[model samples]
Target: MRRSKNRGFGIALGVAIGTSVGVAVNQVAVSIAIGIVVGLIFGSILDKRSQQQEK
Candidate 1:
């Protein structure tokens, strides 16, 4: 449950960052897509680390 929350937060943060990058590059759509993928990856990494700590 806690891991899921972290993932959600990561996704939101990624979107925010993606939006900004998109604006800078004038590619909102592409940036958002990339952001989502990156966010998911980051979220999973975080989840793994947290799990390790818990153990």
Candidate 2:
């Protein structure tokens, strides 16, 4: 449960950062979409790391 929550937080943080950076770079739509994708990828990576740690 704690691990899941942490993963969720990580994902949200990634998305927020990615979107903000994208917007700052002036690539609005494309940046947002890319940000979302990258966020998901990063979230999954974090999840994997957490799982490995648990074991």
Candidate 3:
């Protein structure tokens, strides 16, 4: 449960960061693209961390 929550938080954080970066850069397409990339990166990081913790 806590792990799930952390993952969600990480995703949300990624999206927020991506959106902010997009807005700052002044491009909607770039913002959405960045958001997805950031989300994936966050997800991967979280997955790796979880695996490490499990080991």
Best of the candidates, TM-score = 1
> Which residue pairs collide, candidate 2?
none
Off by over 4 Å in 1: none
Against the unseen true structure, what C-alpha lDDT does each candidate score? 0.88, 0.72, 0.75
In candidate 2, what are the lDDT values of residues 1-55, reduced to their tens digit? 7656755676677677777887788877776676566766776788788789989
In model 2, which runs have C-alpha deviations exceeding 4 angstroms? Answer: 1-11
lDDT of 1 by residue, 4-45 (tens): 887887888888899999999999999899888888888998
Q: Look at candidate 1 and give me any clashing residue pairs.
A: none
Candidate 3, residue 22: lDDT: 77
Clashes of each: 0, 0, 0
Candidate number of the best lDDT: 1
**2 versus 3: better TM-score goes to:** 3
TM-score (all chains, Cα) for each model: 0.89, 0.62, 0.64
Model 3 global lDDT (CA atoms, 0 to 1): 0.75
**For candidate 3, what is the TM-score?**
0.64
The total number of steric clashes, by the backbone 3 Å criterion, in model 1 comes to 0
RMSD of each: 0.9, 2.5, 2.5
